[model samples]
Target: MDIGILLLGVAVLIGAVVVSATGGDRKIARLDRRLARVEQKLDAIAANLGVDLPEPELATVKALLAEGKKIQAVRAYREATGADLKEAADAVERLGG
Candidate 1:
């Protein structure tokens, strides 16, 4: 009886781990998609604005977009240009090129 209980406990623990891991993976995937969408928007904005940024900062912004951190990316761009969200996103869109 004791051995059966121990086995059951282990099985439960394994199940819990799997569930948590799957949940985390799903969240990460959702975030990735969101970032991609946001990046596309920024790229469009940048192209319309006809602006360019250094490759390094542009790369960082791209990574931030992929990570679903648009607000952060916008803030960074705003700091550099003293621009608001719309302007900053537009600048980013141009930079995406």
Candidate 2:
């Protein structure tokens, strides 16, 4: 009878932990969505204000640099953000090239 009670307590504890973990995951997912929305709004506002945005998410630029295409990367950055050659080169340099 004592063993049965102990096992039951352990089961309850495990159930509570699982429930808490799943709750945390849901909260994190919700926060991620909110963050993405905010970022989109901010990017739009920045564009209207003629502020150049970073291109860490510019996959093609990253790929170009990775494939030994610094010039192409600079061009891509320029095209994407309407940056000047010097600004584009600086941006590409921050990509570790």
Candidate 3:
């Protein structure tokens, strides 16, 4: 009888582990999809702008934009490219900035 109970407990533990793993996988998948979408948008923004932004610059600009740092974005663009303010703004506007 104890042997049967032990087997049943092991089965239940295995089932619970499987269920938990499946749930974790689902959450990871959703996070991956969300990340993919954000990456696509970033790519689109980069493409729309004529400038070829490096990965670091792109990431920084994304963070700046998220923080509502429009002026900072323009300034950073100018500083990075040594472009004038007008040119920087133009590039940003082209990118839907």
Whole-model Cα lDDT of every candidate shown, in order: 0.80, 0.91, 0.80
Question: Which sequence of candidate numbers ranks them by lDDT, best first?
Answer: 2, 3, 1
Query: What global local distance difference test value does model 2 have?
Result: 0.91
Worst 10 residues of 3 by lDDT: 53-62
- lDDT by residue (1-97, candidate 2, tens digit) is 9999999999999999999999999999999999999999998999999999564457889999999999999999888888999999998999866
Considering every candidate listed, which one attains the maximal lDDT?
2
Residue 84 of model 3, lDDT score: 91
Give the residue spans of candidate 2 off by over 4 A: 56-97
lDDT of 1 at 84: 83
* Candidate 2 TM-score over all chains jointly: 0.56
TM-score of 3: 0.51
* lDDT value for model 1: 0.80
lDDT of 1 by residue, 11-94 (tens): 999999999999999999999999999999998999889966554345566677778787777777777667888988887777
